[model samples]
Target: MTKRFLHITTLFVLMISVVLTGCGTEPAANDSGKLQVTATTGMIADLAQRVGGEHVEVSALMGPGIDPHLYKASQGDIQKLQQADIVLYNGLHLEGKMQEVFEQIGKQKPVVAVTDQFAESSLIASGVGGGTHDPHVWFDVKLWSGALDRIEAELIKNDAAHQADFEKNADAYREELAELDQYAREQLAQIPREGRVLVTAHDAFGYFGKAYDLEVVGLQGLSTDSEYGLKDVQNLVNLLVERKIKAVFVESSVPKKAIESVVKGAKAKGHDVKIGGELFSDAMGSAGTPEGTYPGMVRHNVDTIVKALK
Candidate 1:
């Protein structure tokens, strides 16, 4: 063959070899050069993973059932945050103890505070146990859809190549979350109006109750760290006695003792209040478990509440 022809033929073969060899199949766990992502909780981590797709390696500071409100970031956690390309956290003081650390990271990394992006008017006050916003947004799937969009925007900003993929996943996940909301409403519909009262260890489910037309009576405030005054516990127990409520729930993230106290007090007042199955309040189930996903977490809570109250 002529030299010119040979050179062109070689180049064409090389290009074809690269394509045929599946050179692009290893779809980049490091899409913008090994993006390290850290999320505050499992729910946020799951969203980050969906939005990041194969472009990012995501880690959550708070694992399933680990309360973000009281999470103390260890030395290793700091390193994760320091090295991460993007940091995702639910704002509104959901990570109460770790708030300052996350705030510090925001100055350096492409930190996206998901909850703060929502309207303040949408947040309900913690009522007597005063925190400005209720941060258990994942329980209310509609609210979480807004948060998911913010996460997608951040992922796109950090890794432009995955923008379309990120958007596609976001749209799909948003639809799923929307469906969860509808299902939640339907599941909750089974409960009678007076039986719709959800008394739990903390006020995390305020948004859930508001979204699903349930009455949420929380023993404590927004944070599990928020101490329940004697009067508050007494009032809850008294109410349970008077209302003839059968069950109260303890949170997986919060100590079970508190809810047990409520149960005991209710019994003393001539009422039978069982300690219902543990609910996911500030966090979710273990990483590999069904409740690790947003839909499963909310579904579990809805089913638990329905079984207890209905």
Candidate 2:
């Protein structure tokens, strides 16, 4: 572990000690009688909101454009988790740095991973060793529907009185996801097979490529914490030139420099590859916007990819 992570862990332990001493019991529902749910990512937060409906007041720790892999919880974030009736995270090491914090808070209340319901066959291996699976399951619309079931189950378990309401909301939301899944399939099908390659700054879209039948290449590995060298850039440039690929996309959460370097390298190699558009990979767009919601984010990505590659 790096010095920063070690420092954060130390601070987290201290904070948790104080929180545990101050509160000996589970947090009660807010004045609105809604469960105070803390989710680690915007996608998971959206899931909690849709499934819990009026019974939940959801807060996302990692906001739009914030990369979860490198996110370290702050003392305030720890306080949020401590005060929450339940905590929800993407798990699968997506919030890698915050795992210890979650473990500590989990002892105090329900801490659930949205991807817990996924079978071994449903996950894609990161190939980074140690049997790690890719944590970006939300990219697959149908696969992400599993998260709805998990979240609804948790909400009902915590607030059993609202079981019927939660079930109703989940059914409605599932229909919307079914529609979004079909939209993604139809839209992404427009790209010709040869032009269906999606090159981005990182490997967060492996599930997306598998779901939509596109080939994905990333300059960086699964985590932005992973590094890339000059040779990696040259290799990607060569692939783009060889495949006659016209576009490369940058991610909102990751810096644009890496993809920019690839674009520069491609130009030098006589391949006119352009930065297709900014894609929401690890993060979503601003709150209150269409892209801020899960379905909107998926639609935006599908439209952007189709328009660029078609």
Q: Could you give the C-alpha RMSD of every candidate to the true structure, in order shown? A: 15.1, 1.2
Tens-digit lDDT string for candidate 1 (196-292): 8898988888888889998888898877777888899899999998888888898888888878888989888788889778898788888778888
Q: TM-score, each model?
A: 0.86, 0.97
Global lDDT scores for all candidate models:
0.78, 0.90
Clash number for each model:
0, 0
After superposition of all CA atoms, the RMSD between model 1 and the true structure is: 15.1
lDDT for 40 (candidate 1): 82
User: What's model 2's lDDT at 119?
Assistant: 93
Q: For model 2, give the 10-residue run with minimal summed lDDT.
A: 21-30
**Top model by TM-score, which number?**
2
How far residue 141's Cα lies from its native spot in candidate 2, in Å, is: 0.8
